[model samples]
Structures are given as structure tokens and as C-alpha cells.
Target chain A: MAEAAGYDPLGAAGTWRHQRAKLVVYTLLCLFALYYVLPLGVVILNSFRDLPDINRNGLIGLPHSFSLNYWSLAWDKFCVGGTCAGIEPFFFNSVSMVVPATIISTAVGAVNGYVLAKWRFTGSEVLFGLMTLGVFMPGQMVLLPWARVLGWLGLTNTTSGLVLIHCVQGLSFTTLFCRNYYVNIPDDLIKAARIDGAGFWRIFRKIVLPLSPPILIVTVIWQFTNIWNEFLFAVIFSSGTHQPITAALIALSAGGTSVHQYNVESAAVLIAALPPLLVYVFGGRYFLRGLTQGALK
Target chain B: MAVEPVTLTSVKAAPNHGRMLRERLATILPQLVLAPSLFATLIYVFVFCGWTIWISLSNSSLLPDYSISGFHHYVELWSNRRWTIAYTNLFLFTSLYVIGATAIGLLLAILIDQRVRAEALWRTIYLYPLAVSFVVTGTVWRWLLSPSTGVERVVHQLGWASFKFDWLVQREMAIYTVVITGIWQASGFVMALFLAGLRSIDPDLVKAAQIDGASMPRIYRRIILPAIGPIFISVLVVLLQFAIKTFDLVIALTGGGPGIATTVPAIYVYDLMFQRGQMAEGAAAAIMILLALSLVLVPYTIWKNWRERREAARG
Candidate 1:
């Protein structure tokens, strides 16, 4: 409304020129929106099309015949390894990896954030700054050494290993998220709790923890989507039965010596992409809020 | 209940002890909670980075032998033609992708800022790609760009018989196809950031500019754009690091293929370590990638610190 007021006084005072410009702007926005939507749209439509029809009519064409075969095949029969078992196993791997990683990272991050916000030690700010540095550190810097470290610990090629890796890597972002959210909680409430002879954990348990649902939701959704969609770590660290859907999707779609099964690939990618897509559809505002918090300030 | 006589020293010492205990716990509590994540960062980021640096200088291969060498891997990495191509591709992709993503994102952000209807729907449509993995993004784009079943086929069906959009298989221009997909995936994310920045700008400033008889474009150019300059830098730094670490996208899309046309340092590092079993050289390439990241990140950090200091000073 304020933005509307700012522009309403001089420009677009009910003129033909203004209407024309408005049409152009709306058209461009629609076109860009379409551009962003087209690929996913193509995938969704192609997922239902039979393979032969897809090859005949191209990606954007109307399906000559629709088949749910690809989805069933993707779920039951797409082969990434020697077994012809579908992406079902890998999807479960992603779930197992994502759920625990999200919970652990979010819990650890909440405590870290609480302390960083409320209980400032001598070097806490310095520590916080150092942790923030992890956010910008490229995964390339640690991939080789990390693989070696995981092997040394005998945890390589396991879901737990991937979970641990994600939880650790996720600390920077989740802690930052929780810290920013907790920073806005009034200090008086915390001080009052301190006066009531409550210890640190007690205050957090009774007061701060109750106030954490919004940030927890944001952090969980963020970590879930991130871990679910993560590729680099999953590819290098997990193989065979342990690979997450992201890695498995790559293998199923284009990895190894296999025929390029575009229909199956489309269905599997849609399956791979659907969880986060649903989250965005339902939790768009929260997702946007988390992003802006992490990215902008 | 009988009142007991309490010594002054007893009362004084009791509260003092309580205070001291509380103070000590306060000092130690945060460290206790923070230790796990800090330890993880220490091992994963700092220690591993140091290990990488050391390995880069050593004669490690296949199984990571720990003999100290003198930059042999770096020398070899630089001299290899494939490495040269990957390195060049890194810069090329970074520049084009950063510029393209930022431009398109800014354009979309501005377009969306026009008080449009279905704002949330538009935002969702534009932003959904960011939720999908790069692997999927690359795979989908690869399929869409393939000649037999993709853009070329569709356009040819539409009677543009000469239409040929086969950059996915071309050697000279394959990198640009990666750039295209990168832009497609990321531009919306950047747009979200820019839209947030645009929304946060004080509307009063825009009003003042409008009252000065400036057109909307002029007002934006002279007023709004400069106000949100920091966001552009932030987006650029973030995208720059992304560009440096690009691996899965290029792998799934191009597989560094058509004769290694789309190879980047990340892929090269992966190939060396995992595929070729050249651990030391891979570590060396990894370090180089870290160096490239630091080049962007270090300056961004300094700029942020300076800006924070300036804001504090102003306050």
C-alpha cells in the first residue's frame, strides 16, 4: 500500500499509456513465471506419457497416450545397481537420512543459538563468527578429506554417515537461523527466569523451548529439503543400497551403462523433486522467510 | 520452628558461594552446548581443509601416501590440458552465470514488484526450482536439450525444420548450456532476495523522487537501485561461490562431456580422486577451488565488516 501510494500520485493517473505499460509488465511477469514453470511442467506431463509417445512427439507435445507405467516403474523397477529394485529403497534412504539429520541439527542448533543469543561467554561472538564461516566454505574443500575421515571411522556408505555429515554441515545455517530468531526474544523474560533461580537449561526448557515452534518449523523444513536434495555428499559417501534418492535419481536417470530412459527419468525426477515441491507449495512463506533471513541479513 | 542464630560471615559466604557457582556455570554452560557443533566444524571444515592443504603438497596417490612433496600435484594439475579446460570453464561459467542470474533475478524481482496479482503464486512458480536438486535440474535440462526428443524436435514439428538447439552435445558451446540451466535454476532465488530487498526499501524515498517529476525508471535508477546495492553484492558472492562449487549439475547435465567441455574444478577434483585415483592431484585441485572461493568470500566478508562498522558508526 505504501508502495502504491508512492507511485500513484504522478505516474499511471488513468491514462492509455499507463494501461499499455501495465499490460506489458504483467505479460512479462507471466512469461517469466511460465519460463520458470515450463521445465517442471514438461516433466510432470511427460511422466504420464508412454515412452514411445514421448520419443515421437517431443517433450512439450500432447501425449498420444497417457500411462502411469513410468511412475510404477520408477517406484518398483528402475535399476541403479545390479538389483532391478526401484527407487523405493533410495527414497527410503533419503527419508532416513533427512529425518534424523533435521532433528539432530535443529536440536543442536537451537541450543547453540540459545546460548549464543542469551548466554554470551568471553569468546562466544568470535565462535559464532567462526561458525558462520562454515556457511560459505565450499563442500569441495572437505569432500576428499571427509570421505577419508568417514572411512577411517568405518561409517562410509551408510545412512548414518550421511546423516552425520548433513547434521554437521547444517549446523552453520540452522544455528544462524535459530540465533537470528532467538535474538528477537525480549531479554527481560530471560532475566526474570534467571531471577527465579532457574538454571540455563531450565529456563530454555520452560520458556525458550516453548517459543521455538516457528523457528523449528523453518529450520526443520530447511534442513529436510536440503538433506533430501543434497547430491555431492550422497554421491561420494553413499553407494549401492545407501545412496539417497538424489544420487540414485542421477544413477537411475543418467548414471552408468544404461539406455537413456527419459520417461522413467522424468517420473523418477518428479518423484525425487516432489517432497520439496510440496513443501514449497504449502510452506512457501516460511521457506521464503528462512531464505531471506539466511541470505539477506 | 525455632529461629537459629546465624553468623554474619555465614550469611555473607553463603550468597557469595552461590553467586560464584552461578557465575562459573554461566561461563561453562554455553561452551558445553556449543562444543558438538564447534567440534564438527573444527574437524570437517578447518582440520579437513588443513589436511587438504597438506595432501596437496605431498606425494599422495590412490591410497593417500603421506610423503611430503613440493607442489608436484599443483604443477601437474596446471599442465594438464583437461585441467586447463576445466579451470577456464570455471571462470567462464562463474562470470556468465553470476551476471545472467543476477540480471534475470533483478528483472524478475522488479517485474514482480509492480503490485501484481497472484503474487504468492508467481513467487512459488519462480522459486520451486531452487527446491529441486541440481542433479534433477541437470537431468531434466539434458533431456529437454537433447536433439531427438527435445526443443529441436518440437520446433521441427512446428515447421521450423532448420531449428537446431543441440548445444547439449556440442563441444565448443556446451559450457554455455550449463550456464543456461544454472541461470534457470538460480535466477528465481536471487529474485526472491532482490524482491525482499526492494520491499524493505523506504517507500518515502520513492515518493520524494516521484514528486521531483522523475519517471519510474529514472526514480529506480537514481534512488532504489543504489539503496539496494549491497544485496546485489551479496547475491553475487553467494552465486560466485556456487559457481566455484558447481559439480552435480554439470555432472548430471553434461557429465563434463562432449570431450570435457563442461568440466569444472569440482568435477575435475572428483574425477581425479574418485575416478582416476589421483588423490594428491585431487587435493591440489580441491585447494585451488578453496582458493577461488576465498577470493570471493574474503572480500565479501571484509565488505560486510566495513558496512557493519559504518552502520554502527552512524547509529
Candidate 2:
């Protein structure tokens, strides 16, 4: 029924038709790829132009003359608040907070995840489920209450609070991924360790921990990216000195100076995007795996 | 923080309690490791949420008040023009974003799954947005879409003079524009999930379908779709949660402006608390939004978990 009409209805060779179909599909897929990609290209190109050049050349146009002037301007001589500070401070703040947060979150996450996957206990699934639920709740809706909590702790507008929030938030999804991933590990390794008289802690520390390096690396990269780009909590709980790169980007964009410097803003935007872009370039495989298995799982 | 094994202290208090202690330690370790996270959830969801619910009933202003307000704020919310627009816009935004992201994301996933060369590069290009906060990406989109001083004005100069892509400015089209940007920032995530699901699909099925003269689209629609149905549901749930709780894109992009055209429940609640200083109304609106999400998410989660338990039992 499926094949009778296609064999000779058009009187074309089967090979010819199949080749044509392949070519068409390939073209369509490439076009779809372009649709996903061209906007980013436009952004990259637009970032290099000056304000006047942007008006003259348009966003889609290639820059007639590439200049590092906007990048410089965005970094220095940009009065953020009564002082000349560029995104440098924001970059520093993001690194300081995100680094500690990423490390702490992933570390605790590893243990929590290890326990969940390895241990069979009462209400374990319930604990994991609740963590998963927290992951689904968007940070904006929860930002206020968190900020209030932080304020009471005297951590509001501080680096400590932002880092803690990131660690806490990173717990749910990270633990979920690590747990699911660890579940697939064979049980015989633990059993063998027990036979060797290895303590539970030693078995986990010496055997399972070292073996799961790929996933741990993946977890670290993903959480670093997560903490780096976090905004709502950054905005709510931190101030200028403690803000992440994202909050800085927002502050810069919203507070336009001198006829909406789109090129500089674009440059700043591109600058803000660098860490993530670089992370993806280096660890794209791990990022994909982590995303697939994390909250989505 | 040390991972030292405990002697099952509770059971160790009894003599010759070795076997019982092992059992007790096994039970206690998971809960201890899980304690902080569990306590956080209970406090955040149960306690603060309870407080939010309580305040919605009381005359809580910027400061707390114990006096009862009844259904006053809810009635006011029903009457507020901006809140109504916000609710409608939220519905539209969520619908468009969930649909658009899933569609494009699936296409990307399928293409990548089908032995695309330099898959890592392409996947990276798609998923890079997930690394940036929505605010940063939202700012990027805002600039791209702004009527003046953005790509809109530039497109006019490119000799296509009638390119009226001013959806960001108009009331009716503003929400749609936000949806487009939302999809742009998020579909990569959706694509990754779909790709993972696609990879787990048995190659034999594709081979068999091809042997049967089933075209790619037909095979995908019939075979792949059903196989990936659970994944589809999961992705949609994530997308729905995102679309409903959307705030940064609207705030960073439009500020719920052009006459409240792009406001969602999130932004509506934000304005009530921060901009308008109407804390009770804001809390009420937030509770309403939470209730709406819980209505869909809580029940669906329960059903999915139930089905999952049954399936696991079968296995």
C-alpha cells in the first residue's frame, strides 16, 4: 500500500528520487540551523560597530570599520553610580559568588545525590521529589521571600547571601541529575568493597566518587554557568558591589546614557555573554548531557 | 562536613546492637544528608506560602496587619484593568511560548539526532542562551526589537520600507513579540531534552520504518512521537512553568508597557509589591498565580508519579 504508487508513478529512478529527497532534507535542516544561528551572528556583528555606524550600517550589516572603542567605553568611564566603573566589578562579583556557590552546591549535591541513589530509606523518593518541585518554581516568584529571609539573616546585599541562594537553588536539579546518573552504576562495586571490609564512607569516597568524574565535571560546569547567570536573586538580595554580571547587564541596558548607545550596549551585551559562550564552546557535550538529565529528567 | 560513618548512635546506646545499628545508620544517613533541603522546602513552600496565603486574607500593607480583609483584594484584582490584561497576556504568552519552543526545539533535536556533522558546534550555538540569565538575553532581544534605535529602524533602511515589525510597540502584538523572544532564549533547552529522548529511541524502529517505505516525517509523527510522548509531556510541563512564571523578559524587554499589553501575573504581582506599594494586593495576586500553577503542576506531578510507580512496579 505504501510503496505501489511511488515505484513508477513519476517514472523516475528510485535512487534518483532518494538522492533528491536527501538533498531536500539536508537543505531544510541547514536552513533551520541558520534560523537558530543568524540572530547570534547579528549580535556579534552589531557589537563591533560604533553608535553612528550602527545608525548608518544597520544591525544586519557588517561593520565597515571594526573598533574596540565600545568595549573599552563599556568597561571604563562608564559612570555606574557616582563613580567610574565598568562591568569589571560586576564580573569580579559574579566570579567570586558563583565560584564558591558552584563548588559548595556541587559538593553537597554530590553527597546528597550519592545518598539518594545508593541508599534505600524511608521517604527518600519524597525528598528527591520535593527537590525536583523546587527546581520547577521560577526564581522570580520566590525571589521576594528569599530576599526577606536573607534580610533577616543580615546577608541581604552581600556576596554571602547570593552564593548561598545559588547553592540552595542548585541543590534540587543538580542532586536530581547526579542521583539518576548514579542509580545506573552497578551495585556489585559497592558489594565487592563491603566484602573487602571497606566502610560505607570509604567505599563511596574511594570507589564511586572517583568513577563519576565525568558527571561531576559536568555538574560543576553546569552549576558554574547557573550561578554566573543568575539574576532575580542577584537583583533582589544584592547591591551594586555584590551584583552578578547579569544584574550589571540589566542595570547598564536599562539606564541608557547619551542617545541609547546600542553598539556599546550590544558590545556590553556580548561581553556579558562571553563566559557562557566560552563555557559552552569548551564543555558543550557536558552541558547538553547535564541539561537533558537535570531538571528535565 | 566529614563523610565519616556514624556508629548508629541511637542504636549503639543499646548493648550488642551491631545489626540494628547498621539498619538505623542506613535509614538515618539519607535523611541527614537530605535534612537541609527538606527543611528549606518546608519553610519556603509550606511556611512562606502559608504566610502569603494568610496575608492575602488580612489587611497586610507594606507592613504586616492582623486585621481581616476578607476577599477584598481578590475582588479588587478581578476589577483591575492591568491585572486582567496581565492574566490574558499570561495565557497567550504561555500558549505561544510552549508551542513555539517545542516545535522548533523538536526540529533541531531531530536534525541533530540524524547524524549532523559538527553536532557539538551546532548544539552549543543552540544551548548557549541557557547559560545567560533571562535578563541579559531579554535585554539583547529588547534592543533587537525596539522600534527606535534597534533592528526595526535599521530594517527600514535596508529598502524594505514597509517592514512593520513593530509588535513591541503595539498593544495586541507586544505579548506575541515577548513570546517569540521567550522561545528564542528557551527552545535550545527544549531541543536538548528532545535530542536526549531521541537518542534513547531504538535504531531498529527507524530501520524497520524505513524498510517499510515510511518517510522521515511519517516515521517521526507516528513512531517517534509516541515513543517520545513522555518526554514531550515533561518538556511541555517545564515550558508551561516557565511561560507562566515569566517576568525578566517582560520586565527587561518591555517593562509590561505599551499600556500593560505584555504584563503577566508575575509582572502584575511585581508591580503591586515594588512599583505600586500595594503589598496585600500583591500577595493576593501572587497566591492566585501560585494556586493556578499548583492546580496544573501539582495534580500532573501526582498523576505522573503514580503512573511511574506503577510502571516501576511492573518492571
Candidate 2 CAPRI classification by DockQ: acceptable
TM-score of chain B of 1: 0.91
**Candidate 1 pairs with clashing backbones:** none
Residue B303 miss distance in model 2 (angstroms): 4.0
Model 2 Cα lDDT, one tens digit per residue, A139-184: 5456556757887899878888888788777887778768887888
Candidate 2: segments with Cα more than 4 A from true spot: A1-13, A191-197, A256-258, B1-34, B66-68, B112-116, B213-216
What does candidate 1 score on TM? 0.94
Complex DockQ per candidate: 0.61, 0.33
lDDT of each: 0.85, 0.75
Off by over 4 Å in 1: A1-10, B1-27
Using TM-score as the measure, the top candidate is: 1
Deviation from native of the Cα of residue A100 in model 1, angstroms? 0.5
What are the iRMS values of all candidates?
2.5, 6.6
Per-residue lDDT tens digits for candidate 1, residues A85-201, read: 888899899999999999999999999999999988788888888888778767777887778878888998999888888888999999899998899999999999987668889
